[model samples]
Target chain A: MAILSLAFKSLLNRKLTFFITLFSIAISVTLLLGVQTLKTETKTSFMKSISGTDLIIGSRGASSQLLLSSVFHIGSSTNTIKYETYQDIEKLPAVEWAVPISMGDSHKGYTVIATNLSFFDHFSYANKQNLTVQSGSIDDDMFAVAIGADVAQKLDYHVGDRIIVTHGGGEIEGHDHDNIPFFVSAILSPSFTAIDQTLIISLEAMEAMHTETHDHLGALPGETLLDSDHHEHHDEHDEDHEQHAAHDKHDEHHDEHDEDHEQHTAHDKHDEHHDEHDEDHAQHAAHDKHDEHDEDHEQHAAHDKHDEHHDEHDESHEQHAAHEHEDTQDQRIARLLKLKPENINAIFVGLTSRHAVLGMQSYVNNFQGEPLTAIIPAVALQELWQFFSLAESALNIVTTFVVLVGLLGMLSIILMSLNERRREMAVLRSVGARPSHIFGLIIGEAGFVCLTGILLGVILLYAVLLILQTPLANYYGFYLDINMLTSNDLFILLTIQCSALLIALIPGALIYKYSLSDGMNIKF
Target chain B: MINLTDLSFAWNKQPIIDIKELTIKKGEHLFIEGPSGSGKSTLLSLLAGVITPQSGDISILEQPLNLLTASQKDTFRANHIGFIFQQFNLLPYLNVLDNITLPCSFSGIRKHKALSQSKNLESEAIRLLNALGLDDPELLQRSVNELSVGQQQRVAAARAMLGSPEIIIADEPTSALDSDNRESFIKVLFDECQKADITLIFVSHDTSLKTHFKHSLKLQEINQATIKEAV
Candidate 1:
């Protein structure tokens, strides 16, 4: 207590120089801690942002790009997987749930994702916890859209409001969905990941738009938009009855009517063979018609030589329609998985367990099929570290420089004051005070100055963080609570204090040396 | 009593003070005179044991000052001797009273003796302050810096003369004061030394004050041409 009182009194004597040293130390510590705190929070946030996602499957583009487009709002994918492939992947024995993501569309500058309603049920950020709706619910209807919290707030979107989607993945001009405006059905609470930066729509809606686009573009010369394979096949079966009335376009129409009536008659007999078996019946009918056409061509060729030539020509025409119908049905089912004309670019999988990361990895690595991959949202996002590495290094360099400047400033100030204090020191020595007493006095003064400065700096750090918390959350989805000191913060502050003390010793040592030889009359 | 036998000293290989077989009885008042270059300060330092003689035995009260360790010498000086330097005789940061009490704070023997005579010592300090012709009420409580050089020297004399230490070493105590002040300071100091029956070694260039003291010595008479040459 006596020492403290004396120290306080002595410090009060040199308050200006003492406080200056302290304030500089405090500012440096605050800057260092601030930079470090932001760096750590960003890394933790990035890692936690995608922990719940198991695997991210995208089009057969680069795996890293697919992960980025699907998980992080980093880059875009080159293409998308076929719808059929997505369905087939879902049916695999090891697969639990597969959420398909259709990319390559955008609203304003935000990426527009075409996914099922299950996206809300599955997608997890920060943890494996399910995304909760803060205000509105998930949109289930095909044309309804869901926007993340930031997207909604920034764009002033509300439920029941209609908005048009812009095409080509960004703020591009051409092909706006002006004809069919979408309703804003749901807005997610902020997660601060790619969700906050994207728009969500249904896969059916995406498929419809693609199909409409294809129809808008004129078809090729040899192509036809024929309806059913069964009708086309039957038309091929009756070619011999057709060409006899060579100039009759009405005959072709009449043949179609007869085929329709026959199809209706087949439906009437649907009791004998249920509608579920209709596709099987069609397959059998196609084979039988092909055989009959072959027999007819052979018989005509055998019977009358001129009639055989015309009959053969008619038979060929009937076979062409039957083959066309069969090919059309196959093409439609095959198009579901093929990525060329229309395909799924990404998949958002939500697993039943938090260990869904394993499931995601298993699917990507063990799936026995064409080249494919699964990515857990968290892992994939972490793997996208180009920005994080750059940010960390840049912040580290700046913090280090600030700390050096702070220490140097303190040393310079303390050393300067020591020069003015020589007379006071000599007086103490003359009054029967030992050299050690002078040394202790100087060191104690420095330590007190540093500790005071660090205390002020800590208070300032909390105040600044508290002030910026709201804005940071609103802009970046980061919720930094400044109410209590986190372990990371405590560690940083401790290190700074220790470092300041270490720096303070330099001046103390200088004074100690000065008082040593100069006890005779300490001028230096 | 003080004793010096064959004392020799030097600075950077140049001789300073060389004295052989010098002794002062317990009640002697010895005055040392010297020009600016004469080694009066060096011999005083030697006698105070602030510096070691190259070849000598300086014993105060039968303890050889040079034979004792440096720390022991400090203790001996604190307990048995009082010093008045040419300047800075008192710490400027302390008030006049505190400066007067500082020697007692460091030396236990002095402290015990001064405390035993505490009331008398206070009155004596006041008397000495009065005798020095500094009667202002503000002067006694004021910081050392507020006092004139002569007043501060008087305060230093009172401090050194307090508690009746066996030896009092004054090194040009009046150098900073004017002729009139210096004369008054010497008279009072010489009278106090005689009254206390304390041995006094006063080093100064002012030979005019020699008439007041019982003993007078010149630095050059005892100083060597080699080891005790002038600084």
Candidate 2:
């Protein structure tokens, strides 16, 4: 007790130095724990993103592929299953529910998803969790869209607001449905997923757009935009000229007549640069003239080449058009086969039996539909964890490095002060203190300093995370969900304290070694 | 009582103190004088058990000092010996009362004797301060720094005399004092030691104070040892 009092007194004499060490250690600890906490939370949020969905019965494809494309907004589908497939799959004995997703539209930068009210009612994420309503109701009308929490917050949209949607995803798309704008029906609370960045609508809305008659611009008068051929050509030439000028600006380094080379690539005006429409017109004129006999051979060769080239180009274009036709056909077939007029992308299932996974799996295997599958969220998530586990390991490495640096800084400070404290130690020894007692004093000093630092670190970290939560959710669609320390935090805190205790000993051991060697020669 | 026989001391192979035989009876006020390098401080250290001799044995109160361990030496010093260093012996942070009672706190036997003496050590400290001719009321409660050099020395003397330790070692206690203060301080110290029946081993290079001590020995004549044997 006396030793403790004296140690405190000694520290008070050097308050500035001790406090500097305390805060440095505190900062290092906070960074370490903060990195660790954020990493764990990211993995957790990813796993929780698709909770309510029990069985995702889509067109026949890899289960993994279907999940990534439908749920995560990654990759593309190989083939869309016919609506007949969904109808047949929905009739199985063990099957409780099914939802078909119609993909291929974007609004601003958000994905425009076509699904029914069942998606809002049944889809769960983060261990079969349901979505919590913040405001407004689920979407019901065609041309009515429910936006995700992140999308709504970012765009500042509320119910009754109208927004134009594009036929493809992302903010940079050129076309929009301004003539048939969608009214915002509801806004979801933040779920920290691709869902948070999606625009939810009914399949009827998708069908209605397809059925509507299109204008020469492939859109309604005020909605669609056309790409003018003449203006496009002029823009291309302007871009080429700009590039040529830029090349000329840097031509001083080029000694081999680089300016002429730039002009050739930029604007040769040769046969290779002939416009497609001009070439077609020229080929038609050549075939009509049946020119002079010698000229006839040259004209015939050019016409045959142009014809052959046009045929190849048409073939590729036809192939693309055929694929698009098949996609449209499949979408129509799937819609006609739907038991209800509503469209749902996925279904969340809760079974009284724990064998829900096996039942769902067997039901899908025997399914007479195009191709259907059931996914146990836990199993799928554990497999997905392999990818995110790298982040976890990186966090561990960073945390370990931070703790080591903190300990090193502390050790260096204590070691530096040892020479000055030698006389103080001798005085203590002269006062009937045992060697162990002296050793305890040093260890106690370190423990006191580090324990204070750890407590301070926890407080600082809590405040910082709280301050950053809203911005983090807005910028990254990750709702940090920070609160007072939970059980997991307690376990983490224990680990931190243990590390500090272990590190504090480094200086204690050094002091003990010094005292032993110096013996009576140590000044008093 | 203290005795030494065939004692040889050295400092890194150079002899410093070589004494064939010496005996100090109880209550003997011995004055030890030597030129510089005569090992007066070394002899005092050995008596105080700060260091052990290289050969032979020195006994205090019939107990062999060399046989005691380092911790035992600390205990023995706190209980049986009082030291008055040249200057600045008192802990700067402690007040006059705490500095006076420090030895008793370290050694239980001394604490018992100190508690049973004139009054609780505070009153005894007050008595010793008065006996030393320091009558200033403000000086008693003030920190050690607030006192003059002479007043501080008187406080040190009073602290050293606490619990009446059998032996008092004063190493040039008056060296830092003015001439008048020095003479008066010396008189007060000797008078107190005499009244307590304590043995005094006072070391100084000044020969003028020789008349005050009953027994006096020049360290060079009495200790014919060189630095080699004193290590």
Candidate 3:
């Protein structure tokens, strides 16, 4: 104990060198623990991003790519699964619930997901925790949109604010769907997942926007207007005018049907046009009014016949024309309900039992309608995490080297001072201090420096985490839990301390030999 | 009492100290005078048991030092002998009181003796410092660096005389002081040794100071190694 106090006093005497060594050690400790904490937390948050889902089904592709694009919003899927296949998968006995997601749209750099209300009911994250609205409940109105917490906070959106979505992902310009703007009806609570950066709407609204963009006639059945450049040809050619007049008459006749039956039949008629539009838009646009009318007649004949009220139909036609320039929320909602999605990018599936997961995966892999891939979310997440292990190991190696540099600096400094302290050792020897006392003094100083440095490093780490927690979570969706030290962390710290003592042994042994020879010599 | 029988020592296989015989009774002040490289420091080292002679026995207080191991020798020195140097006598890191009480920290026998003199080590150190003519209470807490050369020598004297060890070995402790301060320093040192009955081994090449000691000898008179070198 006396020797330890002497060592401490000696260190205090060399204040400048002592503090420099201490600061170096403290900074290195901070880096070491910082890298370790980030590695563990990043991996934990990555795994937490998608949970409670048995499998993710997407068009045949790399399972890792599908996981990245669908759950992490990292990239876009190259292919989409047919809506019919999704329907069949949803009805399987092994599947408890399935949420189909359509992507490839963005609002202000945030991805826009098109899903039904079932997404809120079935999609979960971080230990079966369902997403709850922070402000407003989810609405069933076709044009009503629910935005994630990060989207609402970053874009400063509130319930009832109108937002126009772009046709493609990311921040590409000039593809905004200005004709169909959706309003925010709900804002989801923060979940610290990719869901926090998304804007969600019903699939009907998604189909309606694309359909309106292609047809330019607001998805109305049997009323396909020629491209704007062809409008003058209608006046010049009596044949084209007569075709348009007949099509206008057909539209007026259909307006007399009940609202439900009209929307239902209109959706059936729109499906054929949507498929044709997707197959070849230029060819669909080049078709004359005669071909459009013939196709519409076939779709109507396929449905049940209803009585036509000509006067009421004509009045409704005029109202629809008048409402084209300024469509209200109710008018937009009514139009959207009449449309249906043709395909979706991915589907999240939940199973009734964990044991049934493999059978359902095989079922999705051999899906008869289209080529698809179903992957267990947990397995794919682990595979994705492996890709990051190399970078994690690299960071760990760099920080470990930094700690070694700090310890080496301490060793060099103490070794250099040993020559200057020889007279001090001689004085101690004359005063009856054993050579072993000198050895213990050196080790004790090193131990004290390391212990204090570690303490300061931990404090620095917590301070940095506290300051950056909100920004990191908001900007990067990384949630770091600042809790007490884990046993693993304690073990790492103990290892560092032991290494310091081991390094100190080098100088301690040297000084002991010097003191033995310099005994009572009193050079000065 | 201290006795050396046919002691011989060498450094790097070159003879530095060779004495046929040497003996000093208890409470005696003996001044051994020698020039540089005459093995004045080597003789002190041998007396302190820091090094062993090749062919001889050194017995202090009837205990043979050669039989003890290196560690045992260290403890024996701590319990029996005190040392003061020519300069840099006190550890710069410690204050005057801690410097004086340092040996007591290393040796339990010295600590017991010091405690028997006063209530605790601090009071005992103060008593020794007062006897050495450095009675200023503030000086006890002052850093050793702040002391003048003469005052530092006095503090060194206080530390060596603190535990009432049987032997106090000082090597040219007055060499750094002026003549008047040297005399005053030796006066206080001898007064303390006489009060405690500690045998003083004062080694220096300063012949003028030899008048203070009744038993003084030059290195050539007793050291045959120096005689052989002169021949």
Candidate 2's TM-score: 0.71
Interface RMSD of 1: 3.9
Compose the digit string of candidate 2's lDDT tens values, residues A1-524. Answer: 66676566566656777898788878977887688678778778877878655556554556666677678766654346555455555665555666667766777677887766667767777766666667777644445688898888889998767777786564455666554467787788877788888888877666545433244332211211222322332354543233233222323212333343443332122223333222222222223232323534654564455445544565454432321112232222222111122233443344444667687666765666445566666667667777777777887887778777876777778778777777555444333344565677677777777878889988899888989898898898887977566677668667766766677677667766665444333343
List where candidate 2 sits over 4 angstroms from the true fold: A55-83, A102-104, A126-128, A191-194, A207-352, A362-374, A469-477, A481-524, B5-55, B65-70, B82-105, B111-212, B215-225, B228-231
Cα error of candidate 3 at position A449, Å: 0.8
* TM-score per model (chain B): 0.90, 0.94, 0.96
TM-score for each model: 0.69, 0.71, 0.86
What's the best-to-worst order under TM-score?
3, 2, 1
Over A185-267, each residue of candidate 3 has an lDDT whose tens digit, in order, gives 89999999999999998887787676644444443442344334234535555444554454343344345423323334433
Query: How displaced is residue A32 in candidate 3, in Å?
Result: 0.7
Best prediction by lDDT? 3
Clashing pairs in 3: none
Poorest lDDT segment (10 consecutive residues) of candidate 2 chain B: B222-231
Question: Where is model 3 more than 4 Å wrong at Cα?
Answer: A170-172, A212-214, A218-337, B226-231
Give per-residue CA lDDT, model 1, range A77-143, as digits (tens): 5565666667777776555677787777778878888887677777776767666666666644445
User: Positional deviation of A343 in candidate 3, in angstroms?
Assistant: 1.7
- On DockQ, the leading prediction is 3
> What's the interface RMS deviation of candidate 2?
4.4
Per-candidate Cα lDDT values, in order, are 0.64, 0.66, 0.80
